[model samples]
Target: MIGCGIGGAAAIIILVVTMAFPGSTTTTSDSSILVDPTKEKQSLFTLARVMIQNTGNIPLTNITIDYGGGAKDFIPTLKSGKTIILSPPDGNSLQFVRVTADGGIDVYKAYREPVAMPGMMGS
Candidate 1:
């Protein structure tokens, strides 16, 4: 009976540790353009960063990054398998990002904040 109790306690400890430190997240896509947005906490402020990658066999052209509120940036070309990082305009809270380019390459991604609770899954 004592061994059973010890095993149960150990299981609980492992579960709690797992919940406290979650695993990394990975985004996979078969599309020509991949857009990923993430938020990082720095000091006392949270900053958002976006990563764009070209996965096609050919180069892309006329790329645009729309940050909502009429703020946008453009890229003339992106070589195949190339990646770039973008920051939203100053004083803008990054809720989501939309990327578009010629050849029907369009990708929209939202920033997901991680929230872990006892009975909830982290996002």
Candidate 2:
């Protein structure tokens, strides 16, 4: 099951570190990693899946995610089957929020707005 550190970027990271899945913990800065897709989906807030590999041959628990650029954060989920799902905040302007997991830094740019959906054709 996924643990704490879902919303509110600041306090999230601390909870993640407590898990320490990767055996060793490495602190990451805000400007290190980056995520794609500038907007969130309607049925779902965010469709971004982050793959965190504990290359050190250990399990890293207590993972956390922080969003910089002042954008709100989302609920945290485990990377099941190597893919972790993320839900976005209520606001429309994500404004390129940053991410920090298990002390690993990352940046995500969610679309300000969604694009046209399918079935618009033949109208």
Candidate 3:
């Protein structure tokens, strides 16, 4: 009975935190470039999974991605409809991801706390 009560309280706290802070969201000054990570598959095998879409007619170059620690500069030129996936050095939980394109820069903030997925721990 005591254990059950504690578990219930913990569940409530998790719910509150998840509700207060949502998952990755994008904020950008430019509309040509769209950085979407939610659409990509997030797996433990990779650090970060993101899809960079260039909507403008011109090509995008000198792409830069920055997470909590540092920035990762990509050399490959991005044409229209070309997407790229970036990964952190550690290959794990990323606090946030910031992307800079030719037009402008965009920042995507992650949730404050991580929510556990079903059967991730191999129950």
lDDT top scorer? 1
- Give each model a TM-score: 0.64, 0.34, 0.51
The model with the greatest TM-score is 1
Which scores greater on lDDT, model 1 or model 2?
1
* Candidate 3 weakest ten by summed lDDT: 38-47
* Residue lDDT tens for model 1, 51-102: 7888777787899989888889899999988999888888766887788888
Question: Please, what are the lDDT tens digits per residue for candidate 3 over residues 47-122?
Answer: 2455566765667767777665654656457886666666556644555666775556455645243345686542
Q: Which residue ranges in model 3 land beyond 4 Å of their true spot?
A: 1-31, 38-47, 91-93, 111-123
Ranking the candidates on lDDT from highest down gives 1, 3, 2
Cα error, residue 22 of model 3, in Å, equals: 10
Over all chains combined, what TM-score does candidate 1 have?
0.64
| Best-to-worst TM-score order | 1, 3, 2
